[model samples]
Structure formats: C-alpha cells, structure tokens
Target: MMDALERVTGPANATPGAASSAIAPVLAGPPQPVRVLAAFPAAVYLEHATGLLAVVAADGVQHPNAVVLSVGVAARPLAGLHVGQEGTVGDGAIGVGQLQVTVARWFDPSPHLRATSPPLIAGKIADARAHLMARTGSDSHDLAVPADAVAEALRSGDMDGVLTAVRDLVGAGPGLTPAGDDVLAGLFAAVVTLSPAVAPEATTTLTRTLALTGGAVVDRARHVTTAVSAELLHHAVRGEVADLAAAVLHAFTGRRPLTPALDALLAVGATSGRDLAHGLITGAALVLATAEAGDPDRPATTVGAR
Candidate 1:
C-alpha cells in the first residue's frame, strides 16, 4: 500500500497568527518530516524518505511539486537554508531549519488537456517543432539517436526496444534533471496522456505496455539519476508533469497557443527545455503513427527521422 505521505493531501495544521501560502495541490502531501535536498535563492527542494520531492518556490511558475510563495516571501529567506538541513510539514507550513512557509491555499496546476482532433494536434506539433528548431541551434550533445530509438520503438509497439532506449536515456547527461531524463519524462507523459485520444481502439494494449515501461523506467532511474530527477520520473510515469511541460502539452492538443507555451518551456534550464520539447514532439508524432497503423484506410505516418 502507498503511504499517506505519498497521497500528498490532508487538512493543514493551522497555527495561530500564521499566514497561509499557496502550494501546488500536488505538493501538499500529508504532514511529515523531510530533509532538504538542495537550496537556492529562488527554490528549495525537500525529499521525503519515500523518495517523493517537493519544492518551495518564490517564482510564478508552479512546478508540479512546488509550494509557491507570494511576493511577500523574498528569495533572501530561502538563501539562509542549506542542503542537508532537516524540516517538517505541519502547522500549515513547511519549516526547513529556521525557514517556515505557511500554506494559504492549494491551486490546480493547469487544466487537463482534453481530447482534440488529430489533425489539429498534428499541426500544433509541427508548429512547436518549427519554433524549437528556429530558436535553438544544434547541440553536439543532443539525444537524437536514443530519442529516435524510443520513438521508433513506441511506433512499432516494441516493448523491449522501448525499455532498451529508456535505459540508454536514464542517466545520459549532466544536471539535477539530466537532459536525457527530461526527454524520457516528457516522452512518458506525452505517451500516457495523449495515446488514448490518438488511438482509442488500442488504448488497452498501450496502457498495459506503458504501465510496465513506466515501472521499469522508475526502477532504472533510482539507480542511475539524481534523486530529484528520479522522483520527477516517477511522477511523469503517472502522467504528472511540471506545469511548464503541461502548458506545452495543452498547446499540442489545440487547447492553447503553441508558440507562447513552447517559448516558456524552451526558456527553462539551459538545455532541459529544448530536450523536453523534443521528447514531447517525438511522443506526439509516435501517437500519430500508432493511430495510422491501427487504421487500414489511413496512410502510415512517418515518425520523424530527426
């Protein structure tokens, strides 16, 4: 059984005269002690023993696992905390060492991306790809080979190939969230979330295959990547993505404008955004191919060679 803390929700522990802060509802896990993983001026990440990660951010971007503070909470206060410091979640606040942030409310991260016409989704995907290509130059370190392998595997419904490509990506780059891991996360989120819409008849088979793949990805990630990235992968497998990534997905399905959301995602950490965008595009394209493969009258869609 999953622990209550994993559920990430319960009544806040209210304290007298304490002000509440807004948290991404997903981050408000049951009150429990946590240890600081990393600390920066803009954000502090806390890790639960169960391997869940939560972030306290002083910015407007509401990461899936973040507790967003109001403007009143300055970056200076977060600067005082250090990695390895102990903390607690209670009294409607997240206390890390001497820093305490109360929970005022929990906000939904984004509207769920609903099913839309495949032609519209395809056009948005093309637009997003063009935007990414125009804005970012080629990188010598790009994960094109492994990413394509994964997309091709998904396109052909080859579970073994998917796992092999995913293994290659688990720890393939540098950073807290390595570029390869980001790609995998984006791919996993897109496949799990969009497959049903794109290929309704194959949904059952795809879901079973993805459940197996997602479990293996999480298991492999625990051994190969940073704990923060591993935790994020775990959530991604379950179709929970960072708000920035979710925005791009929203656009891909035609619920919102593609360029603005794509630009916002592209502006994330040096290469993380672009890598994620690539993965999202690849996964969406694979969905189109899978749909075509299931329909005799439709021409097979070519999964991108890039």
Candidate 2:
C-alpha cells in the first residue's frame, strides 16, 4: 500500500532533461538492468542481480538504497509497471518498462542524533511518547508483548533476552513491511544511532553490544521476514532509516519539532507509523537506561516507564 507521502506527491508531467545540469553523481560501474519487485503510484522497488534492493520514490524521500526522482517525474507511470519488469539504473536516470525518471538528489539515510545531556534527551523522548499516545489514543499495540520484552531486555542490558524477544517479533504481522518488522527496524535504528550520543562514555561497550545484537537481527530477519522488510531491517541495524523515521529521530535530538515530525510519521501506513513510533520510544528509553547503567551518578530508570 502507498504511504501518505506517496499519495500526496501523486503524479506530475516529468521533464527529464530539464534538471540535467543538477543531476548528482551516478552509481559506480556500468548500468545493469534490475527487476521490478513491486510498483506503487509514487514508488518502485527494484532488485539487482546481487540481491540488493533499491527504491525509486517520486516524492524525493530518501533511503540509503533509494533514488529520489525529480519533482517533475510523473508518479502515475510507476503504478502501471509490473513486478519482474526490466529496468536500468545509472547515468542519473532510471528506465523501467515505459517509465523513466531522472535522479534529482541523493542522500545518506543514516541518522545522526546529536549528543546532549541525558536529562534533555530524556525529556525529548518523554515528549515524543506523550505526543504519540495522544495521537494514537493507545500506549500499546498487537505486538506489545514482544515489543515490551525487547525494550525490557535492552533496559537491563540482557543480550540473551533481547535475542529471544526479537525472534518472536520479526515477521509477526502483515504488510510488505510487517508491523513487527517495522517495530524492530525502528528499534534497531534508534538504538544503533542514539546510543553513542546518549552515552559517549560507554561508546566501546555500546559499539560491541550493537555489533552482536545487530548481526543477530540481520541474520534472523532474512529467514523470518519478507524480502523487503528483511532488507529494511538490515539497513536499520546499520542506523539507516526512511526519511520519516529519520525525521522523528532528529526531533528527539532537538533538531526539529517533535509534534510535527512525529505527526508526519504517524500518517504513514495503517499501523506502520505507530509501530515504528512505539519502537523509537522504546529504543530511546533504552538508550537512557543503558547510559544510566554505565554511570553510577545517573539516576535509575526503567524501560517503558512512561
């Protein structure tokens, strides 16, 4: 299903040559044709021979493995494309079936949450949770049990507990990006990206912990989730996320307003936005707990206490 951003972007008459001068650097090597894995009104998922996934979005929302088309590109043409249709990506343009889109921009989707006092970070997280609950009118969802287990494990620094809960969460719900997988993606991205910022003093320990848990997530995800979701989880483990998810993280770091950024995220898929939000809040809370665990002076905190 198309997300809110895709629906809003809609279709436009594409002038592919108009932005020729502004095209960013193309991917390395000779162009290779990719198979369409899925096509939507404003987005197309493609698979390369190497098994890597790439997304082409008309809305210009960036992902680590995505190509943002120029605003002039017509999204309607993408909807007509079928899975397994041939496409070629290189030289700043993507040609799929009868549709072609010029690349206008590229970005690294990995989030960088700025370092701040733990108290300030905690307050930002609290505000995010409150805003989410107010918007959704609920603090928990269908996968709350496993989700809470993951958060609790993180809070107590129990790697074994985390892995056990993660096994239950992956591929547990419906959708191309299952609700459970979305939660895990959000959790992995938040924890991997925000840990160092919240606990600079514990960087070594955090890094090691992330490596072990992140590797486990990637390995298990491939076997349990859809190809698209598994790929997303792999990226999330490395701290890369969709633009909306990144916006929420940025807001938590005081880089943007919490309500608007979070509201935009909450508008995504049926429950994807809320599930990701829950995971983000859980992951943020975990950061605070982990940081406090390494520092005796910091006050104790529990996961999901909010």
Q: Using Cα atoms with residue i matched to residue i, what is each candidate's TM-score against the true structure?
A: 0.85, 0.84
Clashing pairs in 2: none
Q: Against the true structure, whose lDDT is highest?
A: 2
Give lDDT tens digits, candidate 2, residues 1-306.
112112221113432422211112233324677788877766677876554445454563455566655442363545578888997755555667677655443456777778866788799888887787788887777777787788777655578887888988999888888999989888878888888777866544545566678778778888888878887887788888888989988887888888898988888878888898888888887777778877789777776686
Model 1 TM-score is 0.85
Q: How many pairs of residues collide in model 2?
A: 0
Q: Candidate 1: misplaced stretches above 4 Å?
A: 1-31, 72-75, 90-92, 108-111, 138-141
Superposed by TM-score, candidate 2 places the C-alpha of residue 34 at a distance from the truth, in angstroms, of 1.4
lDDT of 1 by residue, 1-306 (tens): 123223343234421112112233223455677888887676678876566545445553455566666642354556678888887764345776666665555544433668776677778777777777688854223587788788777665678988888877888889988989988888878887788766767545655677877788798899989987887788777777777888888888887788999889988888888888888887787777677777788787777634
Per-residue lDDT, model 1, residue 272, is: 85
lDDT of 2: 0.71
